[model samples]
Target: MLELLIIACLQDQCREFSKLYDPAEVSLLTCMMSGQSEVARWQAAYPEWQVDRWSCGERSTRAARL
Candidate 1:
């Protein structure tokens, strides 16, 4: 599926990025469900970087009702 492909690409990019910059020195913010999983996996792998998750679904729904 397309989602899987995108995740694969992101994982590859992250792997490459990690080679240059220590993951412990970087901060990542993302909204994709897959991205969250990747961050969680990274936490297990690195255990030192900061990862944050935010959802706008409620805000969007409230705006749609206005």
Candidate 2:
């Protein structure tokens, strides 16, 4: 999955994004870097998450949900 994600990032943006994982939440930055369909890729990555949903580009709120 990391290799696939790196491929997507390298192909799409020529930039790098870091990865961090938690038992509770996922990162949108990680999702965008993966270059798969935004919604589908994210859900697939963390099928067991029980928290609320979220997205990137939010400000002043730490941007995490649930």
Candidate 3:
């Protein structure tokens, strides 16, 4: 439901979606997709999100340091 709308917003590059939904929700979705191969495409579509790619190893290292 909401996931579909979010995906559609990302695919369509809809700025209005941000106005309608919480920025945190959108940020969460973007972060969830950040590790995927489609990340580059999503990043390009939502440059405002400032998405970054972090491999599992990198995440583990960061978690260990914390």
Candidate 4:
């Protein structure tokens, strides 16, 4: 599934966060189109924070070793 990545900050305190779109979009075009609303929702929740940048991509998974 794809995820929407967001980098936002309150003044100088920066943080990175992401969420997977419900049901998931198949292509980057779809992701980009839908990402705006997702961003808006995030902004509304944290009005004080400013969004530095955002994008959509496949979710990253950490490898496990024995």
Could you tell me every candidate's TM-score relative to the true structure? 0.29, 0.25, 0.25, 0.76
Candidate lDDT values, in order: 0.32, 0.37, 0.36, 0.81
Q: How many residue pairs clash in each candidate?
A: 0, 0, 0, 0
Candidate 4 Cα outliers beyond 4 Å, as residue runs:
22-26, 63-66
Model 2 reaches what TM-score against the true structure?
0.25
Model 4 agreement with the true structure over 21-62: per-residue lDDT tens digits:
644436767888988998999999989999999999876567
Question: For model 1, how does the per-residue alpha-carbon lDDT over 1-66 read when each residue is reduced to its tens digit?
Answer: 011111123332432112122234332322334455655675677554343332212122233221
Model 2: runs farther than 4 Å from truth?
1-37, 58-66
Candidate 2's residue-wise lDDT over 5-66, tens digit each?
22123233433222334413545466455434654555467554322333333233344422
Best by lDDT, which number?
A: 4
lDDT of predicted model 4: 0.81
Name the 10 consecutive residues with the lowest summed lDDT in model 2.
1-10
lDDT, candidate 1, at 29: 27
Residue 30, candidate 3: Cα error in Å is 19
Pitting candidate 1 against candidate 2, the one with the higher TM-score is 1
